[model samples]
Target: MSRTLVIGDIHGGLKALEQVLERAHVTTNDKLIFLGDFVDGWNDTPFVIDFLIDLDKTHNCVFIQGNHEEMLLRWLSEGHDNEEWRLHGGQSTVDVYGKIDADRVSAHINFLIKLNDYHLDDQNRLFVHAGFTNQKGVEYEYFKGMFCWDRTLWEAALSMDATLGRKDLFYPQRLALYEEIFIGHTPVTRIGYSVPVNRANVWNVDTGAAFKGRLTIMDVDTKEFWQSRPLPELYPDEKGRN
Candidate 1:
């Protein structure tokens, strides 16, 4: 049977990304849902995009727009950035692009431009780089940026009162909107977990490849996970986002 895999933030750790896919025994029959931030951090930012674009030709791939992708696009296409972007692994991407030809740079820009803000599968599971705020669901979301920047949804999930039932008036409405929500951006490593963290119906899959953790991919239905060696080991010479 085909599997639907939800991947965590890559942060340009292409070696780690490749290893986990191999360990997971990923097949072309499987559907890959990337949680974004494919660029920045490591040194292979451009190569990772190239592999992803090529992978899409043979397998079903869903790409969610990450905040890093958005930041990279603005810098590449218009030389615009939020200033803080450089401090958070953005310069690594800039370093790679500085040597890449214009044609490839343009292609990478187009790739970012085409990424989805959020993807809701037939099972009503939402996949986004970050959480949405509107209690009604992503359809009712007013600020699209929240799809790649919001942390409150995951925070709420993490802090959910175990005694709180869905029917309770005080229960978070955001958690009730989807059967399950898969998100990246906020690394679970912040709380000392290096694996996928589940709280309520939301799963935070970012294992902090940008820092000292590993890159991960999870079978959404089975909840079985595969991870690369800790990224620091994969690229010992680099500090990544640390």
Candidate 2:
């Protein structure tokens, strides 16, 4: 049977992305849902976009918009670069395309502009770059920015001690809107895990590919995961986002 593979924040670690895909044995039949942050950090931002474009041709790929992508889009469209974005890995993305190709950059901009805020699969699995503030089902159209920037949802999940006996009392009702919620943005490495972290029905899969951890991909149905070598190991000569 075909499976659904949910990937974490890529952050331009092309090699890590490639390795995780290979390890996961992803095929055209499998649905691939990327949690975003596809660019920035590592030096292969352009290459990462090119690869994903190619991958989408063969597979069922759902790309979610990330805060980094949002920042990049704002910079491109508004012609005013955000210093904060540049400081947090966007500079590397700009550096990758030193002398920007207007046509290519335009294409990339279009791609980024068209990214969805979130995706809900047939199984009621909600995939987003970050968490939502909605207490009911995700209102991505209304809270596009929050879909890729909010941490309150994850923070709420983290605060709940699943080890406690009463799950319904501790787990927020918002999370129950979906059978499972998969997110990126907040890397699992912050919690000291190099693997996907699960809390109630929310799963954080970003293993900090932009920093010290590796990129991760998980089979949504099976919960089986695949990870790349650490970012430092993948790109020895560069500091991704340390």
Candidate 3:
């Protein structure tokens, strides 16, 4: 049977990405949903983007726009500069793009430009890079950026009272909008988890590959996951957003 797999933030660790795919035994039969931040952190930003673009040629893949992708787009298309972005791993991407030819740069821009803000599957499963804020759900969110930048959704999920039922007056309405939500911006490692985390109905897949954590891919339906080795070990010489 075909499986739908949700992957977390890459942060440019191509080795980790490759290892996870191998470990997961991914095939063309499986649908891969990537939770953005394709660039940044490790030195393989451009390479990761290229790999994903190529992977799409043979597999069903959904690439969500991450805040880092947004920042990289701004830098590539408008010459916009965010020092904060640089400090957090943007410089590595910039350095890689500097030596790349114009055609590939254009292709990377095209790839980043066409990323999805969020994807809601037929199962009512939501896959987003970050989180949405509006209680009414993603459609009612006033700012499109919130789809790729908001943390409130995750925070609210984290803060929930386990005994609260959906019908309770104090239950969060955002959690009621979907069968499940998969997000990737905030790392679960921040909360001391080195693996995927489930809070309320929201699943955080970002195992903090950008920091001192592993990259993960999970079967959305089964919740069975596979992870790469700690990124620091995979890229021994570089400091991955540490």
Candidate 4:
């Protein structure tokens, strides 16, 4: 099979995303695994969604639902007006698609609702928007908190050497389950982080493109990566949260 490339948070930084793909020289045979956050915090949410949908139609693309995407689906299901939605970039989404007819909106919401929580490729790579489950009485399969806000699993996965003061954080150590995990949802200062805990695997590829940081992509098998520097701020010009 061809190699798979995993991409991290877009956050509406379509320009950066496109540039990263160009730099990576992504080909038709290569698979793209997107770690969600497809929209929000930037001006091109509609364009990004449309581009992603088209890409999926033409290529082999696997996308996991990020917390921001989950929020969008929730808002659509329960009426799109709430304090939380307004605070978390939903207003911009509404502004983009609110003028569209009801049928299109319903279709978009339905498309998002069907997204899977995680996707495991044949090559033994786990692709998810965030890290694995929570430790406090939450099953890994049911750990919604980890996907959106939990940092424990993310840190543990990246803590390569115990001497670095990270082992204590992941006490009762859980052996890694996959050969590699390609994840997003936490934008690191760098384009990617790797922990050789079990093998030469485990990677976090979120570079916070929407926050005037880099956008990144990594090949799952070869570990080849590419990044695009952020452009100057445009529109609304406010800081965003993870």
TM-score of 2: 0.95
Cα lDDT listed for each candidate:
0.92, 0.88, 0.93, 0.68
TM-score of each: 0.98, 0.95, 0.98, 0.80
Give the range where candidate 4 is weakest over 10 consecutive residues by summed lDDT.
191-200
Error of 3 at 157 (Å): 0.6
Q: State the lDDT of candidate 1 residue by residue for 22-45, as single tens digits.
A: 999999999999999999999999
| Residue runs of model 2 more than 4 Å from their true location after superposition | 140-142, 163-170
Q: Write the per-residue lDDT of candidate 2 for residues 1-242, one digit (tens) a residue.
A: 79999999999999999999999988888999999999999999988988988898889999999999898888777776888888899999878777668887888888888899899888788998888886766863466678989999899889887774334665687787788899999988888888999987889999999999999999998999999999999899998885
lDDT of 4 by residue, 79-189 (tens): 656667556666667677766677766777777887767787676567777766644322354757566655666666555564432245544243245556667777675
lDDT of 3 by residue, 45-129 (tens): 9899899999999999999999999999999999999999999999888888888898998999999999999999998889998
- Pairs with steric clashes in candidate 4: none
Residue 115 lDDT (model 4): 77
Q: Against the correct fold, how does model 4 do in TM-score?
A: 0.80
Ranking by lDDT: 3, 1, 2, 4
